[model samples]
Target: MRALTVTVRDASTGPVVEIAGDLDYETAPRLRQAVEGLALEPGTLLVLDLARLELCDSSGITAFIVARNRAIAAQAEVALTAVPAHTARVLRVVGLDQIFNLYPDADSAALPSAVQPPPTANNR
Candidate 1:
């Protein structure tokens, strides 16, 4: 069995997790751990770049869902980018395509600028 490797990189959107190799029962936990470890801020958007992902199974799909939930819990958003055709089909079949924000690339999913108004509780 080929070893699975997930590389993480910081992007303007948020943390970009690049997954490669086979994502199965044995390697899904690592992917979940990597996503959970990131302390994302509210409104931040996490982009999962799956262009390099070679394979995936039910466990792998579950890991992706876990990552999405984690991001939402932190008040951040999560997007799937460059998902392989096979995986995309699986997601569609499972109705996850509607649940996750899908992007063609990382650049397309870049986070928008913050638009919160300045605090005015104690202005002089």
Candidate 2:
């Protein structure tokens, strides 16, 4: 099986994680670590640019969910950009597509400048 590689970059919106190769059981932890290490500030939007993503399994999907939760816990927003058709289909089937904001590309996701408001006590 091909090894999965995750490349992370900073963008104006927030941190942009660029995923490549296959995301599976062996590499899902790496993806999780990369995401967990991010210093997500309140009101920032983290974008996962998946244009280079090659493959994903159940573990990969779980990792994505974990990332989303992390962002929420940080009082930040998370978005997915450039999702491949296969990955998109999987996310949609699992109802995760509704959980994340989807963008056509990194630029589109970055164009938005509105800052997310801090989490209210009730929301937390």
Candidate 3:
């Protein structure tokens, strides 16, 4: 199985975590440790980007729930971005799709609105 890697960075709204590789029993703790270290502010949006995530086992699903709880305890919001179709299907089947806000990409998740504002007439 591929090893998991989580890269953390700041976005316009809050912190963005890019998760790559497999998230199984062996590597799930790494994600939990990384997330637990984040200093999330109240109302901040914590985006977890899984664009490159190769796999997510039961432990990984549990880790996601833990992350959601952590965000809630901090009074912060959480979103999952670029979830793989297979992963999304699993979450849907388990009804987690309703628990998490999902976006097509990190950029979309970081936006104040799903779409950008229109330019003013002055632009002409």
- Which number leads on lDDT? 3
User: Tens digit of lDDT per residue, candidate 2, span 1-124?
Assistant: 7777888888887899988889999999999999999999998888888888889899989998999999999999888888899999998787777677777887777775424322210122
Candidate with more favorable, higher TM-score: 1 or 2: 2
The TM-scores of all predictions, comma-separated, are 0.86, 0.88, 0.90
Residue pairs with clashing backbones, model 3: none
lDDT of 3 by residue, 1-124 (tens): 8878999999878889999999999999999998999999898888889999999998999989999999999998888889998899898899888778878888987777732221310111
Each candidate: RMSD: 8.7, 5.2, 7.1
How well is each residue in 5-87 modelled by candidate 1, as lDDT tens digits? Answer: 98989987578888888999999999999998997999788878888889899999999999999988999888888889999
Full-model lDDT, candidate 2: 0.82
Q: Residue 104's C-alpha lDDT in candidate 2? A: 80
The residue ranges of model 3 lying beyond 4 angstroms of the native Cα positions read 114-124
Task: Pick the TM-score winner.
Answer: 3
lDDT: worst 10-residue window of model 2: 114-123
lDDT of each: 0.81, 0.82, 0.85
Candidate 1 residues lying further than 4 Å off, grouped into runs, are 111-124
Q: How much is the lDDT of residue 65 in candidate 1?
A: 95
